[model samples]
Target: MILIKFLFITAILYLGPVVGQQECVKKFMDLSLVKYRAQNIGTESMTGQFMASYTLRVLWEYQFNCSCVNITSLILGINIRRVTDSRRLFPSVQVFTPKGSQYNLVTGSERIIYYTTSNVSTNGMIEYPLDPPIKVTNGDVLAISQPFKKASVVRVYYINGINFSSSMEYHIGSKNIDTSNFLVSNELILVYPVTSGYCVNSTNSITAEFVKKKALEIQRSQPFYYLSQYIYPQIVFSCNGSVTKWIFGAYSMGSLSRPELQIWRQLGPNNYNKIGSSLINATKMIGSNLYEFIPEVPLQFQEGDMFGVYSNNMVNGDSLILYEQRESGPMNLRIGPRLVSPLSTISFLKLYQFTNDYPLVTVEISQSTDLEESSTTEYSGSPYPSQLISKPSQSLSVSAKWLIGGIIGAITIISLASILVLACIIVFIKKRVNLHNSTDYSIIDTRKDDTKKDDTKQDDTLIMNDMTSVTPMQDNSAYGSTHDAAVNENPAYDSYSDGTYLYMSNNLYATVDEVKQDQDDDQYI
Candidate 1:
């Protein structure tokens, strides 16, 4: 009897928590699982625009009987492509209790229950967590208000083909929302915590395995053509799970006609089949003009499967420009062929993907173990070879080497050009100084020659006067003696052609005979 009692107690102890946990988990799942969601069918259907400084209020009627429920988060379906910067797209979220006839106020008092800000990273439906999760009872009318700031525009999807006869209440910037003809639910999702008991955990506790699949890391080469015609740039990737979302870069000349984006699966080498297509709205583009595509249903791709993007909207011979990497270098693991025509495949395109599992985690985690062993067991033996997903580190190393080489070459060229210019300037200045000195020397030499010529002419004239006066003096001795004496006494006296000897002192003149007589009288005295 003791043994039986012991077994019974042991069984109860083991099964009690397990049974309780299962029940608790179910309750939590029912509570936390998304109850009401406005779904978007395709990218083309999202045409509603929410501008900045305007508050968009969406009314949700609670129909559950859980007594008291916890609101965990809010999921907003937004087109991120319209924003210039995803980081700048901040909108304040508020939960309110609806008032009477006025849809703007929750109650007559307009009481706010919960408030938080949304952090948007990518273009798609994003989940915003609420701190101190809101608690609500049954039959409560809840309003989700999103106030957009200045310069913030969000593209929202609306439920198509539904008519509202004043029963549904929604407001845009203090104005009554009228979807009188068709029913439109601006895709707003509310999240709740499913389990209430200690054994149950919230859904947010579970972490998802994220994988990134990139086509090419580097930009493609030149010879790019503006795709005025239908051109499909496809990227081939092998993923086992469903593709939730995709992002790609594009250049638009802002044509009136909308461009169409299509996805295709590869059946064989160079053969592809269309899966889904969407009309890309140019007005809803974000940073770098990248567009995000989220299908109504997640598209699943098997292992070693190939996918491509077909873009069509070439009006007035407008081309969809693409960068093509022509040179042979390290190719991306997800890189595929550039299908120009039905029979032509010579170039490559740039593309990337986010998968359910890490593409390079296996390659990164198994460096210590043997390559063969690691390849077979790592990350559940990902079908892709390590060489494929492993970032062409070797190629990157080589490319880095080339990049450094190119930089060095550029620096060298600039330095050489600078030195050549400096040298040329120096030579020019030296030549200018030399020419100036030569000019100065020529001027000095010319001045010296002119002075020497003047001196030579003066000496010649004095010699001619002395020779002519010598013959005349010999013919007249007495007169010549008197004249010589007078000339000696009055050194300033001069004999003119009129035969008058004049003595000049300062500005006064006297006869030479008078000057000689005065000199003789002074000698006698």
Candidate 2:
């Protein structure tokens, strides 16, 4: 019961008396983009009266909901009105039943509908009604469909008094909107533009005239073709040196029209800074903080920025090409060590082409500030018009030589470092060996006295011999004090026994003592 009540209330909200009285506003709008063809509106024919003007093709779609519960019959009408003016633009008598789809629609269907074209005669209003309202609820969808009818397109007329170069503004609806208060975070404003001119010398009037004539001749040789894309001319602004954002727009032409537009951010402090870095010579500053890291303008532009049709797969065509400068005007666009302009500004242009066998096309930029004048030699090997080939192999070989030389130098330095380290290690080992040899100690002990000493001490030697001989025949009790006293006389002797003898004056005896002590400690632990 609650759901039914809610549906009833929603139906009233959508189809109330107030809403029924007013027409539904459309949501979609589109404008066609045309290429660089001269406007046909003003071109005069041999007849001299006037030319048939062109129309701007437009497309739009609108949606509506149907909600009628248990209804048997009803009539509905639709009206089309220009948003700028409240007046309707189609006939009012013609009506239509909301169509479901192109395939689902047929003749004699009860829910079928029809419509009429611009009834500007009737103040531009179109209306249609449903014969019987098919049982529909709050969720039922109703769609009205039809092709573009008469006067649906915007008419372009030739007016002798009107100017072709002036700007025009059109609104989708005349409803007043407060866009002035809307905040814009990023925006681009073109300040100044660069123009084409030739250098003049005061001393030679004929030479200057000849140069101008040659320029004009070149222009004549390549007839100008109006391009479709909008181009933003190169702008040079005298900023307070605090501007942190900009945008670069360019286009690709040829068989594949892959147009690319980018908004590059100038790197700097995240928050705005009052003072910027000092300026330097205006060479391209790559991988720096002042080059790419800021907000950019949001809009589409067109002018004459043209480039080659970049073709990689199909290698037989000439590509559309554009130029960018790596330098700036007289004063370097930098602050301290930070550079302002790194990648060059894009320059879109219009130029002609030659046949496949034509000579290498050379592009040169004359020096104006810190950058020296330089030229690029481009070759066209074949007749394919959309591809850009690299420079000759001979140039690449020259560059490769320098790269190889640097690599070799780096390797040599690393090798020398390794050798120095190895020499130091060898010296350290030799010093360690010398230290061990100088500290080494050994003991020499005599087991027997010399015969000469015995001869000199004949009385004492006889007594010693007599005692040794008696000890060999003595019992345990008799030899106990004597043998103990004899062993004590040799303070270096650790153990002594009469029947067995063993010598242990080497380091192995000390090692065995240490192992035995460790075993005793392990058992205690």
Report, for every candidate in turn, its global Cα lDDT versus the true structure. 0.30, 0.21
Per-residue accuracy of model 2 over 297-401 as CA lDDT, tens digit each? 222111111111111221133222221211110101111111122222322112111111100011111111112222222223211112333332122222233
Error of 1 at 350 (Å): 19
lDDT of 1 by residue, 339-371 (tens): 222212212122221111000000000011111
* Candidate 1 minimal-lDDT segment of 10 residues: 357-366
TM-score, one value per model? 0.26, 0.15
Shift in Å, residue 463, candidate 2: 43
- Where model 2 places Cα greater than 4 Å from the true spot, the runs are 1-224, 227-410, 436-525
- Scored by TM-score, the top model is 1
Question: How well does candidate 1 match the true structure in TM-score terms?
Answer: 0.26
* lDDT measured at residue 79 in model 1 versus the true structure, 0 to 100: 30
Q: What are the runs in model 1 whose C-alpha is more than 4 Å off? A: 1-53, 61-64, 81-89, 98-125, 148-150, 153-155, 163-525
